[model samples]
Target: MIIDWQHHMSPRKVYEGRGGQGGVVIRDGKVTIHLKKEVYQVEKHLEFMAGAGIDACVISSSPISVDQCRMCNEYYHELGSQYPDKFFYLTPCLPLNEGAFDILDQGINEYGYKGVIISPQNAGEMLDSRRLWPFYEKMSAYNLPIFIHVSGHVLGYDAYDADYNLNIAFTREADIALNTLRLILGGVLTAFPDLTFVISHLGGGISSTLERIERYIDVRGEKFWTDCGGTPPFGAPYRENFRRLFDTLYFDMAGFEGGMNAVKCALTTIEPNRILFGTDYPYNFHTDGKDVARYIQDIRGLDLARDEINGMLGGNAATILG
Candidate 1:
């Protein structure tokens, strides 16, 4: 069974309420800045899935405010319930807000959400901030992966500038990579060993940056250890610890155009089983210009063993979601 691990879903009313078209509208080769809610509709979504030969998908919302997280999750839950075989959804919660834990619990236990989606940054707090520990602990206890996606455009840049679009695209991946590295280097992975994190956009260039990161850690390990009170002796090599932490995390091939070099880099840096197929769906049409069928074909065309290909296509996600 083929699964698109990073599909997005937003309520139609949310778009209509804002006096906007509810679906993606491309003009002059540019996607308009609007929530494509029509693609999230049950019938339309299912039709796309069938056309793409996708058996199931894990859905989440387009980035919305903290206040709307619960409502959007509930809406997605209702949609998933109507076609349980083809859909599962992630719970959305503002980790820093009150009642966040309750919302997560309700989504998982009552609504049967497969997992949770948290933006790489909440307000000004990065994912590694202590404020999010309670939510992470709860997710760890539930044994579900945290789906990390980026929200908002590049900060401190002129939105109307010629390079705005390019900057936004670069920033999305950069932020995800930065937050991911923070989570690893900040000792969150070590502290919550049972917690699994599924980073979107093939870990946002992490595979290519692994070497540089290791070198940086090596150069700064002593100061970092001293600053943290050095209670745990820095006996083992830092690289070993980094590898252990990195191995525990998973990455999805979303927002990529089946670039063999990038895929090879990820395979070299991470285990095949830790890689999952993700299309980023409606948005992928804007970024990658390839449909779901072509995405499947691209992965199949890779120089991988049958079992490895199976794992990337769906097996890995099934195991992670379960």
Candidate 2:
């Protein structure tokens, strides 16, 4: 019954690693960056997906291009063609490319992709870069939420600084928050108004900014968080911005445990209906849905109504994919 928002399938070349180790050897806790195809073979992908208990999985890619995006779009198309209803698509948004929106339109009309996913860090610049405005416009037109996912490290500063610092997760989390703020300050959210947006990795530290990034008005007089890329905190200039800002947004509980504390706090601050259930499958540290189900069980026992749990489990996502 869980509709996972973020999932990555292996490319045809994924099985080509040494002894078929799959590229990106997880060397010393560092990402070596391998060719996408060599890491995600088709057969292994379907085998991993068969019993995941998910109604549908929207596949995303790392830092691939318009061509790779096209390839993945077709790949997901084949999966959807074969499975009929189980497999879905989320075309990638090429970084800083003029053709990104064209591809988005192509994915929608040609491939029937449900939505588009852009790496918050690699998204045509940053999430806030004005260069991405065309991309946002199309999303608003389709009423689709752009799911922001990171392939590996998100921070531009220390992505390869260390062999994988313990703070890598936190770094990506901060990257999302900063990028969201950049979008806010840059007027991406306010201008589009209805272009839906979703952030994976538990929304990339977005729950922390509910007070600051107002959906409607730009708050120039708020006590903004410092971590949100030098912006002021939530206050007068950004009043109902948060209200509308949060209106069509949602987040997936991907790596729930690492940021469970933040996720719990986010639920309290934002509408419980906006939180969606997702388990980063195939790459999950825990076993499967049963293990990820614990988080939902806890939420059910919380003060939240049963209806809210239903929305988080599928309603919100179904709304997005539709």
Candidate 3:
């Protein structure tokens, strides 16, 4: 049972009505995303899944306002109800917002959502903010994973040109890496040990830099905090073994568009069981179902054992989602 954990879905009428032909720009043009009919049209999405040999996909939105999250989640819940085998969805909400816990509870208790998707950073607030500890605590108690996907392209660069180039090249990936580290260094992992987090885009290419990040801790020791000009965040203490902490999180194979090089790189630091199959569909070239099938074949062609391959395909995610 292969589960593509990073599939995206939006309501057809809401998406098309927002002036998006093949795509749309929202949030006063602060964000732009390509939206295709395949994103919302259920039959079309199912066809792509079949072509790709995907038994299921855990779906979520590209980017939408918190105000609209409830409605979108309801729509997703309806889809899941209609086709339980083909669709499972992650509900989205901003943790900082008032009544956000209520929103989350309703999504879980009422709508039967599989898990929740949240931005790596919300309105410039990092995931480790104390205000969000309540959110993390609730999620931990619920025993549901938190899916972190980079949103809004909020890289701190000031003068770079070309929005599209910046986002794909340097913006979103960096945010994913930075926030992944923040959740570690900021001590969220230690505080909520039972929490499960699934990071998108292979942790924004984390395999390439995991050692260097870990090396800082090995060389700097406790002084690493003073070097950063601050004490450890109050009430949030991190473990000395950053790699062990990092291993606790899961990564999804997407955004590389089926490149074996990236997959190979990720495997160097990430265990095969910790990797989940993901196709950044309807947005990348993988829109054609054949492309995703090839992507799966390439993973199967890797040197890993059958069990390892099967784990990445879906077994690991089943354990996490359960």
Candidate 4:
């Protein structure tokens, strides 16, 4: 019953006529890949899953344009339908698009998508912006989790304008962490208490920085709101409110090397039930399926009980997705 919650599948058309090098280019310490052929090769993917001992995966696309998002969702829906038990998928939609809610409704009701995937920031609007409230409200009503992932291109900065590895390794996490903090401190969780947000990359370092963030709130609560630019009405008892809101969020263990130290950090800072297993597969393919096993082993080697381990491995995701 092991589930990998953060796998990606790209649409086939992206690599149709690409040159050798298989649509992958490494320039200036950044890896730019158009995995057109590999993403749609379902048989190979299933074989990889079998070798890796993964029972199921939630498939999403590499970030793309708004029209491409619809196309990717259609392809993923077809794939999931063909292998319902082995695959689930998240619907891709840009929150700012006029038809975003329509896409979500059709994807969930008609296509059987399990959730939705969004970037940390889209078109200069952060996830907590008022413009996204309708999408959040729709997802909350359906009780489907929102998957937050980041792409170097979609970020506020120009992707090719800087070194890729440096951005991914360092700057990306900061952006994700900042966006997550905005969601918490901006009162998104308070406003939509039932919404389930599963942020990837271990909350982009949120677990590690929780104490510092809380302390900042303690010392400069007023300035925090002022910096956020709007005095949105979050409930009273600000400190406790912050903690409660944070506790309601969930994180997926994706994008990190399989190591016990990160797991230990997460366990210490976040609730066991709020953590989910995710391999960030295909992206980690250089490990040849070993990373998945290592991640499982790392969690198993922790001081956690069997039930806690089970929850991290699959149970938590099952509960969230259901």
Top lDDT: which candidate number? 3
TM-scores, all models, native as reference: 0.87, 0.78, 0.92, 0.89
Clashes of each: 0, 22, 0, 0
Residue lDDT tens for model 3, 157-246: 455445445655566788788889899888898789899999999999988988887777777666778787856542212334677788
Best by TM-score: 3
Compared with the true structure, all predictions reach lDDT values of 0.74, 0.62, 0.80, 0.76
Q: After superposition, how far is residue 235 of candidate 3 from its true place, in Å?
A: 14
lDDT minimum window of 10 residues, candidate 4: 14-23
Cα lDDT of model 1 by residue, 1-322, tens digit: 8888988776766556445664543323333344565544667666677777788888876444554676776787777667768887898877777766787788889888988998787766887788888888888889988998765543332443452354435656777888888887766887788888999888887888888878876777766567767432323578777887888888998877556677878888889889988877666553223376776887888788989899999999999878
Among residues 3 or more apart in sequence or in different chains, the pairs in candidate 4 whose N, CA or C atoms overlap within 3 Å are none
Cα lDDT of candidate 4 equals: 0.76
Root-mean-square deviation of every model: 4.1, 4.9, 2.6, 2.9
- Candidate 2, residues 102-218, lDDT tens digits: the string is 777777888877788887766437876767776677677887668877545444555435645534446666776676656655566767777777777766657666554453244
**Deviation of model 3 at 216, angstroms:** 1.7
Q: Give candidate 2 regions above 4 Å deviation.
A: 14-20, 23-52, 98-102, 151-155, 158-160, 163-167, 208-237, 257-262, 286-289
lDDT of 1: 0.74
